[model samples]
Target: MTNSPTPDQPRVIATDAALAFLAEIREDHPDILFHQSGGCCDGSTPMCYPASEYRVGETDVKLGEIGGVPFYISGSQYAVWAHTQLIIDVVPGRGGMFSLDNGRERRFLTRSRLFDGGEACPLPLARG
Candidate 1:
């Protein structure tokens, strides 16, 4: 499945790595849910939740699901992302976890690997 964001919003790109990861998981778990949470310093972090219990954030960009997995973007923060295309890639480290990249080389890992079977790396909170 596929969906479009707002007219002014840039297109979201899912990297091959991301697709492969999702496909592997979907083989056993069809109901996969993807979402983003606001991070520290004006950045965002992505998370995958159980399909049975997933909530969409106000600023999330809805990218239709593939292989029964739903995908979304950070609506408010996405605009500020340097690269229009967002690529999800797996970080090369212990505990196999994924990260989000904005195509420009900027990357952010999940706040806690507990959510996605990886190590914990909390994103800095955005200051006022």
Candidate 2:
């Protein structure tokens, strides 16, 4: 039996294509995680990295999980994106230089939709 996310549980969702891509990469790099940047070098795309390699800091917020992968957002960025649901998908292009998906000719992308006034707000930070 598959364990799907409850209605109010997931703050993030991954497309089938994105999940397939992540599965392929996980074979080589098992401990993988995603961090959606607000905007910078990668233009706010969902960047994938080895779990131990990327350091989640005090300002980061854990939105939830997608495909069993924990997704985080920088606190400063979270403030701006708090009202929406994050949609993680894959597309044809080069990912961030530091991201594991780089050089694969396909990159993880972030698409969002408003929360319909029912979904929970952004997950709280560990400390204010």
Candidate 3:
């Protein structure tokens, strides 16, 4: 998931710190993925879980990969976030209750930047 930046490319990315934290988590949980639910309880934060744990429904869309993990968002949320790139970073805090990062003292945070005028459109939304 380490693609060079070039116009609307690589819709999702993780910072060095984020990558390190992800690696740490991966050591314990080999296959994990992330989902940013638009629900109220989580405050729109990205939640990390084992890939087999959370069931991706038909309404969710795969945004892209970050830190070699697949990232997804509800289609409703995707409609609103489609124009921006999701920058996943690590912040000092407890992660979501059901997320893998919960007890790690550092959680995955999302930051975004809008796409440029000449960039290509995002990939086709996939059915979960």
Candidate 4:
């Protein structure tokens, strides 16, 4: 795994709030893995997957475990995220459903909903 960020940079601050959120997911799916990617914004959003079935892209990366859960960073995105940290939180959403937070100023990542004969989860937020 990459080194932790300097004191001035954003470091993965795993607070009780964040740990509680992770615990909820762990209880629901103990085998899930957490990962982050790069695209628009500060970087990309956190993505969860079934650990047993998770696939890594063809890139060199450092794998680290946080809160006893496996986490991965893509080789290409590592440098950009070196000074970034991720925190988890739940926010109120429409219909009383909660949206996930990555502790950044940006709310979440947005992606295309189109798929090939298969369903994909829509992003929690909309993009311009």
Q: Score every model by TM-score.
A: 0.51, 0.86, 0.88, 0.53
Model 1, range 22-115, lDDT digits (tens) per residue? Answer: 6765566566666655556334355665566666656566644533556675656544542344445544433213422333233333321112
Tens-digit lDDT track for model 4 on 82-128? 43345533333211112223332223231212222322222211111
Best by lDDT: 3
Better of 2 and 4 by TM-score: 2
lDDT scores in order: 0.47, 0.80, 0.83, 0.46
Q: Where is model 2 more than 4 Å wrong at Cα?
A: 1-7
TM-score attained by model 2: 0.86
- Which candidate ranks first by TM-score, i.e. highest? 3
Q: What is the RMSD of candidate 4?
A: 14.0
Query: How do the candidates rank by TM-score, highest first?
Result: 3, 2, 4, 1
Worst 10 residues of 2 by lDDT: 1-10
lDDT of 4: 0.46
Error of 1 at 53 (Å): 1.1
lDDT of 1: 0.47
